[model samples]
Each structure stands twice: as C-alpha cells, then as structure tokens.
Target: MRPSTDHPVDEPGWGPLARYVIAATLARTSDGGAVVAIVLMVNTSGGSGWLAGALGACITAPHLLGPFVARSLDTARDSRTVIAAASLAHGTTLAAAVLLYPHTHPAVTAVLLTISGLFGPLLTGGISSRLPAIAGPSQRRQRRAQGWDVATYGISGTVGPTLVAAVSAWASPATAALTLAAGCYIAAAVIRFLPYAPAPGKTADVPRPLRTLTGILASGPLRRTLYLTVTVAFSVAALPVTAVSSTHTLGVSAAAAGILTAAYGLGNLAGSAGVMIRPSHTEADRLTTHLAATVAATLLLITLTPSFPLAVTAYAAAGIANAYFFAATLAARNEYAPDNARGQIFVWVGALKITAGSAGTAAAGALISTSAALPLLLAVALTIASTLLSLAERRHNRRYNAPCGPASPHTQPENGRPHPTGPTDRIHDCSNRG
Candidate 1:
C-alpha cells in the first residue's frame, strides 16, 4: 500500500497546483480549439476532411523534429524561460495565421500552423518536465500531480472545443481561431508566473537529447511505455477526424462535434479523478491489459453504435481509458527516468506520441472518403496489435524473472535502482547514476 499523505509536499495546499493547472488549461485550450477551428474552417469551406487532416498533420509534423528543440531547452539555464520563449513564438505564429488565413492560400495557413507546432514540445513535454520541480520531492505527490496534469488535458479538451463551438455559432471559424490565439497569449502570461526551477544537475553533464532518448528506450519499463503511447496515439488520432465525419454522417449540427468532444474530455476527467481518489497497485502488466481491453471495447462500441449519442458515449468510455493509460505512462516516466535525463525522456515520449497521432490522423483522412467507419476499424486493428505486444512483453518478463533462468538486464524495479544481481543495472543507467 502507498504511504499516507503526511509529507509536506503532499500537503502543499492547492495554491501551487492551481497555478500550474491554469497554465496547462490555457495552453491546452489553444491546442484543443485549434483542432476544432481548423476542422470547421476546412469542412465548412468545401474542403474535404482530408485537407483538414492534412492541416492537423502539419501542426503535429514539427514533433518529428522537436527533440532537437527539446534538447536545447534541456541544456538551457531555465526550462521555464524556454517555455516562455516557445509559447511566445507559438502564439505569435497563430496570431499571424489568424490575420493571413483569409488573405492567403490554404498552403500558407498550413505553413503557419506548422510553424506554430514547432513549440508544441514546450506546451506538452516541456511543461510536463516541470512537474517534478513543481510538485515537490515526494514521489507520491508527483504521481498525484501527474494525474492532475492528465486531468487538465481533459479539461482543456472539453473547454477549448466548447469555446470554438459557442464562438463559431455567434461568429465565424476565423473568430474561433482568433480566440485560440488569444488563449495562447493568456497561457504564456500564466506560465510566466509559475515558479521556475533549474534542471537538476550540471547543464554540461546532461547527455544529448538523442542519446537520452536512446538510453530511455533501452529501459524495459520505458520501452513498454513508449509502445503503449504509440498505440494510444493511433486510437486518439482517429478522434478529431472521426468526430467531424460523424457530424457529416449523422446529419447533426456542427456544434454537436464539440459536444461529443466534451463527452470524451469529461470521461478523461473522471478517469483521472478515479486514479487520484483511489490509489491502485498500478503494475505495468495489469495496467496494460486493462488499457488494451478498454481500447478494443471502446472502438468496437463506437464502430457498431447506430446513433450519434451512442457514439458520444462510446468515445467518453474510450476517453476514460485514454486518461488512465496516460496517467500510467506518465507515472512510469516520472518513476523510472533518471533526474538528469528526465527532460529529454519526456520530450521524446511526447514527440513520439504526437508523431504517431499525426500518422493516424493522416491515415484517417486518406480513408475517410472511402468510408467514415474505416478509420475506426483501422484503430481497432492497431489496438489489438498493441494488446498482443503487451501480452508478449508480459510473457517475456515472466520468463526472464523465473528463478531458474538468467535474469534479464531490463528487469529493474520501478525505483530505477540497480538490483544486487546486476542484471538490471543498465536500465536507464543515466551515466551510471541510476
């Protein structure tokens, strides 16, 4: 069982957590709103969901190159300062897009969005890297904080689209896009007020971000986490595009898309709350099994559902699973990543998640024209593949840990410490630090 919450860190009243939540909410609101706005803008203007998906891909495309940017930030003096700079750049680019989108071609808009995406790592991994510092020194506190962080993503996912839908009803998609830009600026300001803590350890000692990523990938726990992230990304990628397609298929108002999005977000929020309120063992195998099962079940339900309301409910159920999966992976990241390379691990993990999602979204775009249900079917297949992988991982672990057999080098406990037998010594070693 987990220890009691008597640590000073655990009791750090809501003040600091609230500050971080505000920043997270604002940043994610912009992200969430941008997806809705872009989809609405393209779909309303006689563009296929394919074009809208392309724009979405463009926004996440930068994640493919974001590790270098994240590496630079990791080596910087203050991660918060780096975040501020990235937020400014992202917001400015979005503002420019708001102004130029009307007068410019769709290609220009895509370019601006991609430019804005260059800063996505800052909004996601960069900000998340601060949790260790922000949540104080207790592992439990950090775990709880990570749960809250996931909840913020859900909250923003809800609020952002709600804002877009409400504003678009009153005005135009351009105005909704403008509101997203404004939210980014607000987030930037809020983030500035968050306490800044320098990264732990000497800047010069930190490995190159690529090296950091390679090292983390060597860790069995983290490698499993990354694999799970890839699967989650594919499932999530189908969400935004699928929501749009559902709007078309159901003959519903455009605003219904936002409501469906909100249902998923609400489910995410509830899922996060479940973790916070009722602590569990959180074993990787059990969590993986539960997550995969939920993904398969959610997708199948959505695929078979006959009506829009049923679809929304199915998505919400999936959202709960999504939120739980994220919480598990995030907690794993915090627990297993060494202090020095934590930033890089977070960066690459976030980048991988985005890249996978982008691929899924792009694939959905390509297939949506053929049949709206195709993307969901593809997601189910991917989810099953991921489940098989998880089972394989579990089997490998069981065999490797058998008393009569040679212990696997990757079989370290979650604390990231070396076992006495030395089999797990190299797992996330972090220059022999672990």
Candidate 2:
C-alpha cells in the first residue's frame, strides 16, 4: 500500500522509472508503427484503401474493451505476470499478421490485428497502475512518477511515427512491421525483469470491471474530468484537418502543415516540462473550465488569423492548454480512484477519449471541404457547451451536498475494508494532495 504522506519519498531514485518508461515507450512506438505499416502493407499488396481502413478499425475497435482486458491485472496475484503475457501476446499477433499479410485475405489480417489490440491496455493503463510501487510508496513520488509517464505519452505519439517512417524509408513496409514486432518482444523482456509488487490488498473482493466503471462515474470530480476529456478530444481532433486547411488557404506546400503539427508537439513538450517542475493546485472543476476556455479561444484565433505564423502560434498555445488539461484530469483520477480499480478507470477513460476523438475527427473531415474554419467554429461551440455543463454540474453538487472529491460514500476501498473515520477520509483533497 502507498504510505499516506504529503512529502517526497525518502529514497529518490530514477532506476525503476527509467526501466518502465523505456518499456512503455518502446511498446507504444511499436503500436504506432504497426498502424502505418499495416496500411502500407495492404496498399502495396493490391488492396484498396477500404481494406486498409477496415484493418485499422480492427486494430482500434478492440480498444473499446480495454477496461475489461485490464481488469485481469486488478485481480491477479502479480500484475507483472499479466503484463508480460500481454506484451508477448501482442508481439506474437503482430508477427503472425505480418507473416500472413499479402498471402491471406484481409479478414485474416483483421483478426490478427484485433487479437493484438486486446493487449493495448496492459501496455498503457496496466503499467500506469504500478506508478506508486515504481516510484516508492509516497503520494509526492507517485505524482512525479505519473508526470514522467505523461511525458512518455507525449514523446511516444511523436517518436512512434518517426521510427516507423524511418524504417519504412530504409526498407519495405513488411520489414518495418517486423522491426516493431521485435520491439514488442524486447519491451516484454524488460517488463519481465522489473520487480513485481502486487496492488494494495490484492486479495480484496474487487468488483467486476463494469461495476467499477459505474462507481467511478458516480463521483462528481471524475464526471467533471470525463466531461473535460470529451470536450478536449473533440477540440483537438480538428487540428490535423485544420492544419491542412490552413496550408491550403495560405497557398503553402505540405511542409507548412507539418510545421504547424510540430508546433503543437513542441507545446505539448513544454507543458509537460512545466507540470513536472511544479504541479498545479487548482481545483479540477476550475482546471476544466480554464482548459475548455483556452481551447475555444485558441481555435477562434486560429480561425480568424490570416497568416500561417499566427495560426501555428495559436495551435501551439492550444496544445499547451490541452496538455495541462490532461495533467489535471490524470491527477484527479489518481486522487479519486481506488487503487484496486485504478487500472479499470484509466483504461475506461482512455477508451472514452478515443471514441470521442474518433467521432470528432470524422466530423471535422466531413466538414473541412465546406469551410476550413467551420470545424473550428463547431469545436468552439462544443467546448463552451462543455464548460457550461461543468459549471452546472458543480452547482448541482453543491446544491445537493455531494462529496468534495470524486468518490462516493459506497465507493469500494483498495484495502478491502471500511474507510477511515472523518468525512475527509471518504473525500480525497485533490487540490491539496501535494
């Protein structure tokens, strides 16, 4: 169990953090590379774009069940065992898919991708659930560890595509897929060697994944966090399309679009660095409001800007706001979620974001031909609506006397026992956790 404290860990070390970060970053990089590789492999093998799209859907659709797959770790004797198995399984599936690619029907490739996608949660949320154990047993250290984890997320999203593109440029798409498969195995080996620590009270009577998800959604803070997540997903999904549209409007080459995208990536890095240096003390509700407002304002500016430079600047600032929004939501999850169900909550949140973002992306694509600025305008409207909803939610909570933190009174405990005395014990102080 995590030692209840408001200070940094006594023995500060980066060994375990480094190990897990490498493993996770490599694993995710493989995931990112495989997507591009799969599309290339299908297209090169005389398959239509529809086949490639179907294969991509196969790979990502299974992530909707990520929480259920991640629940195995919550119930396992040692989560490392499950993580190792998942990593190996992911690699094996990818290898099989690559080997059978052009020789087999697209259905066969889709099946393999679906099987591989089943392990996505282990590479992400499962690793994250171990942060307290990885960083030593203190809240402050855990927060720092999570910061590192978030940084890896930002880095992976950028590095993963670059690695795939580099390998594909040097060799065939099939070869690139094979390389990523090897990376999965290497990540599995690294995870296997890390010290194993069971989640707090591993023997606790954990509820089913669906039940845990339901309990998490019952909390005021978590609900607000989720609300923010949906809005942010919708707002950010328009970036790529908007970048392309802006490039067209400015009569610039594709390089300009890439530059705008890179600006967002740089802003993400900057925001993550700031969070690592000094964590925020704002309430989750207030953070959500600010994040939504910032996104809306930036998108408005981008829409109104006549030059590419101004658009790029606005996008970068929006990216920073987006990163901080995620940081705030992540901290709320850590503070509010019971340890035993943390993996489930994390996976569910990710799934929700992915689903919402996919919808938003599709919408933006459909509308971008009509007007470049139309999607941005829609995003602004959605964000404002979300902010208003969050404010209304807070008022309802205060009116009916909801708990201060995310958890409700009947929320399950990580230690399989009743919560400690005092109302505060049931309500975590998210704004003051440091």
| Residue 111 lDDT (model 2) | 92
lDDT of 1 by residue, 198-239 (tens): 556787888887788787766666777787788878777787
Candidate 2 lDDT over residue span 87-118, tens digit each: 88888898899889878876888899999988
Per-residue lDDT value at 411 in model 2: 42
Alpha-carbon deviation at 41 in model 2, angstroms: 1.1
The estimated TM-scores of all candidates read 0.79, 0.87
Measured over all alpha carbons after superposition, the RMSD of each candidate to the real structure, in angstroms, is 6.0, 5.3
Instruction: Give the best candidate by TM-score.
Output: 2
